[model samples]
Target: MRAKIYGGCVSRDILNFDEAELIKLVSYNARSSLATLGSNNAAKNISKKHYDSLLNIESKFQRRMVESDFNNQILESAGKGDYDLLLIDFLVDRFHLAEIEGKLVTRSVEFLRSGIKPDRVVNTFSDQYLKLWKEGVDNLFNTVNNTVGLEAIRINKVYWTSVATNPQDSMMLNEKWDIEKNNAKLDAMYEYVENILPSSSIIEVDKNLLVADSDHKWGLSPFHFTDDYYRRMVKIFNA
Candidate 1:
C-alpha cells in the first residue's frame, strides 16, 4: 500500500526509549516532586533536568506518532475507497476527532464510544484495536469501490451513545450493544454517505447511521476526552 504522512506539532522518533527503564523510572518518581525526582538516579544517575527533558521528549514523540499514524490511516482508507464504516478510538481534548470532517467531507459516518464522560463523546481502546478498525475501514472502502465503480465514502462524526462508569461497565456495554450500536451508527452514517457518494454506485450503505456511547468519568475539559482516551483514539485512527 502507498504510504501517506500526517502533520502535527510533535517531532518524530520521540518515543525511542528503554521501556523497562522508563517504566522503572516513572514508578520510582511517581511520588517525587519534579526536582526531587530529577535528583534520584534509580534508573540511571541522570540529572533531574535531563530526566524531565526525557519525559517531555517521550510525550512529544507519542503525540507525533499519533498524528502521523492518524493521517496515514485516513489517507490509506480514502485511497482504498472504504468510506462506509469507520471506527474511531477515544476522542480526547487535545485531539479533536471533529477535524476529520474536513478530510472526509460528508463522505462517511463515525461511531464513537467512550468509557469516562458520557455528556461529551470519547472512549479508550487498545492500540491494536485502533489498528484493526483502520484496516477494516480500508478494506470496506476498497471492496465496495472495486465491486462497483463509485466515489469512496467519507466518515462524518463518530457516534457517542452510551456511557461507562468503569472497565466493567465498558465490558458489559461492549458485549451487549456493540453490534446494535454498530448497526445504528451505520444507519446514521449512511445519511452523510448518500449525500456525498456518487449517484451511480450499484452498492450503497446508508449515510445517516451513527452510534454514540460514553463513560461515567467527567472530562477535565467539557469539550475533550481524557488524555488516555484520546491517545487510544489516535492509535485507532492511525492503525
Candidate 2:
C-alpha cells in the first residue's frame, strides 16, 4: 500500500536573500517610517527606485522568514528530537505519548519473539548504521526534488511505506538516530547563523583592538575554522 505523503516531506520554496543588502535595508527602514520611505516627496533625496527596491527586498525577506520557520518545523519533525514519535505518528496517525510508548512495547515484544534480546541488540548496534541511514534519507530527499510527476510521488510514497511497515528494521538500520539528529540540527543551526550575522560582529578584538585575540574566550575560537570574516560572525552569533 502507498503511504500518504506526510506533511513532513513536502518541500516548500524558500526565499534567498543577500544578507549585506538586507542589513542595509533594515537600517534604512529603522531610520524612516514606512510611509516616509514610500512617499515620493519624503524619499526624494533617495532614488524612488531605491525605495521601491527596499520594498521588494523586505517582502522577500518576510517570505523567507515564513519559509525558514516551515523548513525548521519539517527538519525538527523529520528526525531531530522526538523523531521516533514523529515516525510513529506517521505510521499510526495517533500522536499521544502513550500511543508511542505502546508502539515501543509492541516492538519490544516482536524483538523478543524473534529471539533478539532488547538490551543485547541495542548495545551491539554501531553508530555507522545511523550514518548510512542519514545518507540514504538525504539521497532520497534529493532524488524526490530531481524527479517529477507521478514517478517522484510514487517513489517517495513507497519509500515511506517501507519505512512505516518495518519500524524495527529502520531502527536497526539507524542505530544512533538520536546522535545523528543532534549532528544534523547543529549543522543546520550553524548554517542559519552563518547566513544571518554580520562579519564585524564576531571578530575577536584585542585589548588594543590592533591584533587578533588568540584566547579561546567562547569555548571555541571562531577563527579556527576559516579566516573568512563572515564565519567569525557566525561563531560570534553561536557563542
Candidate 3:
C-alpha cells in the first residue's frame, strides 16, 4: 500500500513500523492544518529569518514538513494519485496558526521551539478559525473526489491520552494539558470532518489503547502513544 500522510506522526509511525512493512509511505506532510492547505497567499515561502531558524531543527523530515506547511503544498503530492491511501490525523490542528506578513502559517511546536516570532497568533476556538477550517475542508473533499476518491482516504480518529505508562509522564501530561477540554474540542473538529466524508474509512482504536509511551522516541506527549498503540492501529488498518 502506497500512502500519503497529513497532520501528524501517528500514521507515519504506524506505516514506518516494522510490523507495517507492506505499507510504503509515498509522502508525509506535517505541522499543517486543513485551514492552511487551501489558502492562496502572496508569500508562499517562509521568511528568511524563519528559514534560518528551521535549519537548526534536529530532524530533516521535520524541517521539510515545516517548509511544506509554510509553502502551502500539503496536498500537492496526493493530487497525482501515486498513493493508494491518504492518511490524516488532526494532532497538528491543535497548533494555533500564526499570521506573518499576511500569510497564515501553522505555529507548530518546531516553530515555537525555533524562537521566530510571528505577527500574531490566531486562536483556534474563534468563529473565524472555524470558518476557515470549514472552507478548507470543502476544498479537500473536492480535491480528493477528483483525484484519489473518497475510498482511498482514511481519517485516523485519535485524541490526547489522559494516561501514560509511567507515573511521571502521566503527571507531566496533566500539568501541561487540560486533557478533557482539549479532547472535547478535537472531537468536535473530527465530527465535522466525518460529516464531510461520510463514506470514507474511519480508523478507530479502543480507548484503552490511548496511553502515552514513556519511552517514545519523541519523548512523552499526549499524542505520542506506546508501541502497543501503533501495533493495534496497524492490525486495525489491515483488518
- The prediction achieving the highest lDDT against the true structure is 3
RMSD of each: 18.4, 23.9, 2.3
> Against the hidden true structure, what lDDT does model 3 obtain?
0.79
- What ranges in model 3 sit over 4 Å off? 18-20, 40-53, 56-59, 113-115
Order of models, best lDDT first = 3, 1, 2
1-239, model 3: which lDDT tens digit per residue? 88888878777889755464777877788888877765454235666877778887788877887778777676566667788888888777777888877788888877776677789988877766777777766767677778979788889999999799999889999999878877887888888887866644788889899999998998888999988888888887676
| Candidate 1 wrongly placed segments (more than 4 Å) | 1-65, 69-177, 199-239
The digit string of per-residue lDDT tens for model 1 on 1-239 reads 11111111110111122222221111000101111111111112222332232233234544333332323333333344323332222111122222131221100011121111112321212243233334434443454456433342223233333434344545655566544544453453345345645544223222222212243133211112223433333343334
Q: TM-scores of all models?
A: 0.23, 0.19, 0.89
Estimate the overall C-alpha local distance difference test score of candidate 2. Answer: 0.23
Residue 162 lDDT, candidate 2, scale 0-100: 13
Question: Which of 1 and 2 is the better model by lDDT?
Answer: 1
- State the local distance difference test value for candidate 1: 0.28
